[model samples]
Target: MASREFLKILSSARLGDVSAQQKLADAYLTGAYKTPIQPANALIWLEKSYFSITNQALEGASSGSTQISELIAQTANIPLAETFGSPAFGFGWNSFWGLAQSSIESDSRSAAQWQLVNLLINPINQDIQKQLSEWIKKNATSLEKVSDLDLGALQKLAKQFLNELSESNSSFATNAKELLIKLQPKNEALSSLWKVWQEDQNEEALTQAAELGLTAAKLILGLRLAQLDGNTETKSNASLKKAAYWLELAAKDGDRDAWYALGEIYRRPQFSGYNAAESDRCFDRAADLGHAQAQLRKGASLWRKREKTEEKIRGLQASYWVWQAHQQGIAEAKELLNKILDSCPDPKKNDWYELAQFAEQALNHHAEHKLDEDWLLLSHRIIIANQFNFSKAELLLCEVGQLQHEHCVAVDIRWELPKILPRLIQIESIQQRRALLAAGKVFAAADLEIEGNLRQRRYRFDQVTSWLVTTFFKDQTESAIN
Candidate 1:
């Protein structure tokens, strides 16, 4: 059931009507109906009209179809590719220009068009390193011209070229300084552009920026490489070496961010060979440089070491470092301070609670980038405590088949028992256990040899438990949960 308005638009579009075609394109581009329409479909309709108008101009060359060509030129700036490329498939360039022209008649596509033009021109035609150096020298006085051009367009082209440059060990490093110097004045804008460029995986820009001694770029590239190291099954010494090299350079330059990054690398046991001593040193250095996060890390490391050694002097030292970090506005430090103070052997528990409340206020004062590891530790502690008290563990198991804490899922059963039997035994409620047993029976209908104790009863549960444990609980064994 097409609406009258839709039918009218479709009828006009079918009669080779440019206006009707554009209107239909607008509908698809805007997703005027509910649930936002597909951008590819929008582009198809828009491109059809665009091509038709262009072909008409080309065919009617003897009669100077200026209007048709003008229309085609106007439509060329639509970001059809950008829209179609998005996961949601929303309209981009097509809607921006069409809507703007229909309402305000403003030409928003000029910048994008200019950028496309520049890309086609390929200002630096030779090797990027050589070309960039020459361009910088030639245009040093005319640097403002680069800024004056469509920045958005130039940024897109830069990203594309930078990606190409990153693929090979080209002259990017040699000319990186010159290019950065040319762009240094526009640091804020360039940084924003860099964020967008990085999303496109423009490694060349990242490499160039790193070579130009951009600490932020160096840190970002290092993090990206570290992320890749995790995704790939094998270790990448090259990635770590590259990250370490840039971080060391940045640290030497007295960049606090670099120091923090170095601390992070050293802190990660798997990545930095579990060099806690070296990690402590890096954190100390970063903390001295007024890095709050490094201070927090240093405090946490000290606290962890104190826990391992059970030395009262080390405990006091950990508390002092944590308090110092807390004063510097580190949220994790405040949290650690609260936990330490709560466990202190003070006669007045109320006073410790009051101090913890104050620490909570301080904790809320700081911003956190990721989930704190303390939460997992605390959850594991709670779970272990519950397991020690069998009644509480049974209560928890009665409510849920598995107790899901931040650290791991606790299935109520002894560790030595075969995997499946414990899960079946954990369901304390008779009805739920019956349902689960019945469900299990569907698979075990043929083999009905229900056997001996919990260990023997786990024969069927073993297969299911093996899969579950391997899939979800494999990494969880690292946590010291009794």
Candidate 2:
């Protein structure tokens, strides 16, 4: 749902309010809540904006006429090619031609309009270019004998030629539409600039292409500008600002590299706009987009939160991100992941409480007390421990069967012992895999109290062990329980 403010602005725009229309156009370009970025819709509103202004200016001299004229002049000041480009008006060649044909009567900015049309429609048609240029030149000149060119006749011929093209729209319009659809965003202006830059590494062409709303050009231009060093602090700051501007534009277009670059800029202490929060957000966006460096950074940052008691749960999260980065071929991530794994207690080195003596006695005790869920759970745990070689801590604290991956089991005892990080143990044999599957079924139906705090679980284990040793293992029971 849109807010009341947006609704009011929308109402005003629909009622032909130029300011409101321009605002809506910018909103569509940049995107806002309930309005995703739509370049085509932005262009349509911008076109309607100028058209409304033009109409107002033509109506008569009024208090708003001066303001309207100023806006028209400002729009007119932009180079015709750029004005029609996707970055400016988001108009395709067909759209521009349609505008030119419809606006012939007003003739407010006919020369520029026709010039853009000529440039966009048929750059290969030299005859049309030469004719339009000569015709425009003659019309702009007011001399009685302007270099032997008849201004009125040339104007008539130009209008007649434009009318003829407009009449032949079926052939040209359909072709232009098809081509535009094929060339996404349909801005030939930027495509030409790409060639211009590639020819001589022209920065000017790159800048133009960036201005024409090419995401790649914006990213390249932003990166090039970001690398620049100025003679003074002021100049350096200015350069950073320019780089940020272009990078932000690209970031808004969902460029991951641009987002990462913006993150670096915001994180820089030397940059005046240094903002740690904003930098974190930018890096988060980049990481979400699968930027390897950002993922590594995010993982390392998460790992740093382990000191906080509440952040222990994030240890697995940190490992997950680091693992993601490692899979993406980041060398540092592999080292960090190794370090995290090394911090975990190896189950093989852990104390063994469910040994053969204890296990056989526990099985006999469980058989005698078949209705006891605790004994049943303990039996399942013993079976798991003997088969998979899990330690007493893992057998007691681990979420059996549920934590099984395809080829490995995730033994997480963090719920009882937050210090003992989770580790994945591989299922090396068919026997081990079957044991795990069987354990999963038994545990799934077991009592929830089977998984309790360290103290409660340790007490339960000791109580069961004491009872089993005394009743089933009388010979060993003579030796006091350890």
Candidate 3:
């Protein structure tokens, strides 16, 4: 059943009220007032509203012109996937144009005229097509002059606009040049090159695309170059260098596979420029970007072989990365994560009450100087400690971001207190997760200088804890007695 408001709008729309028609269209578009979101119905009412508005404009009064135009733009911009649904559906633009042609008066085609002006002239819609429209509007002459403007490969809206423009303007040629000098990487030539490479196994086309600065092409080219010299024992330094150059280019563009491939290239012992540290860094980058193999590799590297206590510490730190890989369906990661968790099973939950209270007082006291005074970090550590049950040593030494995991938090304080073992703490509640998220925010914003070395952190913790206990707690106790 329609709401009273919707019924009223629908009744007014039936009576040829333009504003009511637009409101009815909006109600259908967004399912407002319990109306079903039917794109086909929405377009129907929008067409009715357009015809009514154009009729009114012809009669020398236009009230809802801007509102209707903006609504049409919004509807036009909706993804075609969402627009095409059951009870009578077509492309949004097609339906819009089809109904628009109903007006007998050529000048009364204001809504259709507005759409073309918006698409070709003002270009208000902020999407890929709009961007292409802006480029085409400015480069109309240039587009006509260009030799290979892959019109077919252009986005649907852009292709339609170009075709219409060419039909309307006698000077505008169908054959045109490249229009993607500004759009980089996602051009017609790159798409064509990719298609040719995939179908014909043309390395030359692949090379051309790579030279055109496509990150995917660069990564593929690098991998192919490296594959040709599969055995590192016989691989020439020149071949490895060539592959590394392209991989490095792609890695700089934040391609995960490129980073992982670069890591592998660096790990090859026979490579002239082999660097274990650089290899680890590349793997770390790839792991950070959610690459499964890199995550597993990084996790395995973090897990140190040692005494049971040290193993727990290392395991906690390694578990997060391993678990990440496991979530991505890596069998080896699942096994490794399970083994680590088995060794460093969740300890009995113990929170620091006095420390938590002291942190709160210190936080309020140094509210203005949280970042510069390091009170914010102390507060974050206290929150982490209370929720994850971190030891004082762990709280002082652990890096906040590294320990954060989806299911649990990792705790490793061996950097400052080698005797104190690392531990994995399970996050068992929504409250704990929220606390971790909030604390993580503080650590993310804190400066490296303020976070300090383990020694400085321990010293600050000692100083602050001692001062808060002596002064703040004594004052509170005295007040309570009074």
Candidate 4:
């Protein structure tokens, strides 16, 4: 059973309320809201909340302006109050809660960016301070946005909070080891690390960056280390070990490129972590996440000589993934999908396939002649299939849904429905026959009105009905043949 409160908050979160999302994450984290504590579910909510808040902050940065008067004037046409309270704009709660247009001034909204920033800085739930600190500790990519804070005081405060919440692998601790680095990135390693690496082509700067859990630096360092070849066994062994360590850190964070790198690395039997099983697993993970080339490789991996049953199953799986990659515009995937589909058994034996063939033929004939007898065949077949309890007959009807309204009630009554209604009345149930006859009479009246012949045909309903019965159903076998 699920908690109603948790379900309610989850709905609000899904509706894109940033605060609701954070609260749901908190609920999953603490388990105090009668929801079970699940770290994976909590991380999902936390990710949603963080991205929502960050996007809102970026929007604020782009849209906020110092010219507050123009922004306010843009909304002057709106009659609604800024806030709602009793005796609006009066003393007590109303004084602070509600304000009319005349009460507002440009000076009051001068620091719009600061106001948006303050929302994240001091959220409704104060516990987010600790939650955010721990979150950034693990997902270090968030450092880019945090580092974008322009105010020196806010930057200093953020560093202080992260520093207090730091752990052994913490990015804050690594960057804060020196005051200059924490305050300014370029000068933070001005003297030795950056100069040693940039000017000298040494790997020291990369090592420093990787240690701070920066994903790009880790990838570069891993690649460089993987390329190392030493004259002695001691250094050669050390190089691969360092490469594996750095790459593994990035891969664990669900970096697709890092996982692909590991797959390439393990494909070489000489590498430290080289294992056929691990290499295949890495490729499978990347492919499952929509990597185009990885999808090709994953499909190819399963496409091999095997037992017939096993091969058939793997072939279907490979075709599915390859088809998805093709839809994503991977040319290689498209070529592979065509080959796989061609090699598979024919699909025309499916029951729906037969129905579709009939539909296609009927549609082509109808396309050539607006009110073809073939349209009668198409409609009767669908109506007959539905009577026989064909599960997909309704779906096929929907596929040709446009034809239903293509003819006006006038056309449906005269040359159209009269050609088929006799057989329908004979085969359909009593209730359905009555409904069809009643609808047919109404349509005949409408058809006469549409042709400006209503007064001429007003008393001809019984004559038309009697004619249909005598002409079509007068001979049962003739009606069936038509």
Judged by lDDT, which candidate is best?
3
lDDT (Cα, tens digit) per residue for candidate 1, span 100-201: 233222333333333232333334432433343444354456443243334445555555443333232333422332233333344665575577556875
Q: How many backbone clashes does candidate 2 have?
A: 0
Q: Which ten residues in a row have the lowest lDDT in candidate 2?
A: 173-182
- Against the hidden reference, what TM-scores do the models get? 0.28, 0.43, 0.39, 0.34
Error of 2 at 353 (Å): 16
C-alpha positional error of residue 398 in candidate 1 after TM-score superposition, expressed in Å: 54
Report the C-alpha displacement of residue 64, candidate 2, in angstroms. 66
Q: lDDT of all the models against the reference?
A: 0.47, 0.62, 0.65, 0.45
Highest TM-score scorer: 2
Residue-level lDDT of model 3, residues 1-482, one tens digit each, is 87666787899999998778877877787666668877668777776777787777778885657755555554553333333332322335443443234444332233343343343333234353434445444445533322333333334444444444333422221121012212244778889998998899788998998998887789888987887425455353347888999999877665778899999999898789999999999999898767999998988887753334454455665777887888899998867776677332222245566667666666556644343448577777776676666667777777887876775777776666778766666555766665566566567867757767877887888876777688678978998999
Residue 66 Cα positional deviation in candidate 3, in Å, after optimal superposition: 39
lDDT of 4 by residue, 1-482 (tens): 77555688999999888667766866765563467765445555555654565576677744333222332332222211211121221121111112121234332222222222222243332454344344434445423323333334443553444343222243223222222222334445544565566577666676886676666567667766776323243344346667777877866644556667677777777776678888888888677655677877877666553234453123555656666667678888756665555321232433444444344333335444353332333333333333323233232222121112110111112232234221101122432232233333333434222222333232332333343345334454475789
